[model samples]
Target: MTLTERLNQDMKTAMKEKDKLTLSVLRMVRSALKNKEIELKRPLDEEEALGVVSKELKQRKDSLHEFEQAGREDLAQKTRDEIAVLKQYLPEQLTEEELRQIVRETVAETGASSKADMGKVMKAIMPKVKGRADGKRVNRMVQEELQ
Candidate 1:
């Protein structure tokens, strides 16, 4: 089943079991997917749906950081839980070694000798690592390799 279908099933289960947090998160995800579909005027493929989920996950992480920085432990914990829930839908995260290897290969493929070639390297690598690796992390590794 697609991620959206699976999420709908799980949402039903959450409703039956009275899982408030999971239910709420699932509802939010559904709304985000619906919004994206409306914006694009078409149903999302698996990759596009994954992009929506990844965007939600990024927002939760940002909120967690802001909450902790403001000393709001209660809100921080809630954001952490939301992140954990959303993470179930993302592809397995790329390990540092895997990311580095991909970066090296991309740099070689693009003939990226210095920071000037960062854009080329990034363009080559993003499709390979999308949803699996963080873009900022990939950029950092690319810069390090170039330097």
Candidate 2:
């Protein structure tokens, strides 16, 4: 199923199951998807929709870190729950070794021999990894591989 259909299906299930957390997250994501469609004035293809989901997940992770840093356990837990719900929509994440291997290949492909060429490596690699890997983790891997 397309991401939108999957979201709608799960949202209904959440309502029936009385899963407030999952329901709330799905509603938020659905709204975001709608806004994106309106903004673009066209329906999103699967890749674009996945980008929206990944953006939402990234935002939740950032909020989660802030909540933890501020000692707001309640908010942190809620964000963690939201993250779990969002993760259901993302592609499976890359393993550390797999990510490292990909980073090495990207660096080689781009001929990024030093930190100065980091941008080249990242530019070439980000699209390859997309939702499968976190940007921070990719950056670290690229940095490690370049050294």
Candidate 3:
């Protein structure tokens, strides 16, 4: 199923189960997807839809750190819950070793030998790792491999 369809299906299931947290998160995500569709003036393909989901996941993860630092366990927990719901729409994440391996191979494939070649490496790697690995993590791994 398309991501939107999956979200719609799960949203209905959440409503039936009376799962407030999941239902709320799904509603917010659907709104985000709808907004993106409006902004682009066309329906988003699967990759674009996944990109939106990844952005939503990243926002929660970034805020999660702030919540912990501010001693807001309540907010942190809520963000964590939201992340859990968001992740259901994404593909399974790559393990650290798997990501490292991909980075190494991508760097080699792109003939990237120095830090200056980071852009080439990243451009080549992003599509291969899309939705499966965080971009920041991939960049860091590429940096490590190059150095």
Q: List the residue pairs that clash in candidate 2.
A: none
Rank all candidate structures by their TM-score, best first, as comma-separated numbers.
1, 2, 3
In candidate 1, position 27 carries an lDDT of: 99
In candidate 1, what are the lDDT values of residues 53-103, reduced to their tens digit?
989998998899999999999999999999999999899999999999999
Please give, for residues 87-147, the per-residue lDDT of candidate 2 as tens digits: 9999999999999999988888888899999999999999999999999999998988888
C-alpha lDDT of all candidate models, in order = 0.94, 0.94, 0.95
Who wins the lDDT comparison?
A: 3
The whole-model C-alpha lDDT of candidate 3 against the native structure comes to 0.95
Compared with the true structure, model 3 gives a TM-score of 0.96
Candidate 2, which ten residues in sequence have the lowest lDDT sum? Answer: 104-113
The positional error of residue 65 in candidate 3, measured at the CA in angstroms, is 0.6
Candidate 3 lDDT tens digits, 1-147: 899999999999999999999999999999999999999999999999999999999999999999999999999999999999999999999999999989988988899899999999999999999999999999889999999
Q: Please state the error at residue 106 of candidate 1 in Å.
A: 0.6
- Give me the overall lDDT of model 1: 0.94
Instruction: Point out the worst 10-residue segment of candidate 3 by lDDT.
Output: 103-112
TM-score of each candidate structure, all chains considered together? 0.97, 0.97, 0.96
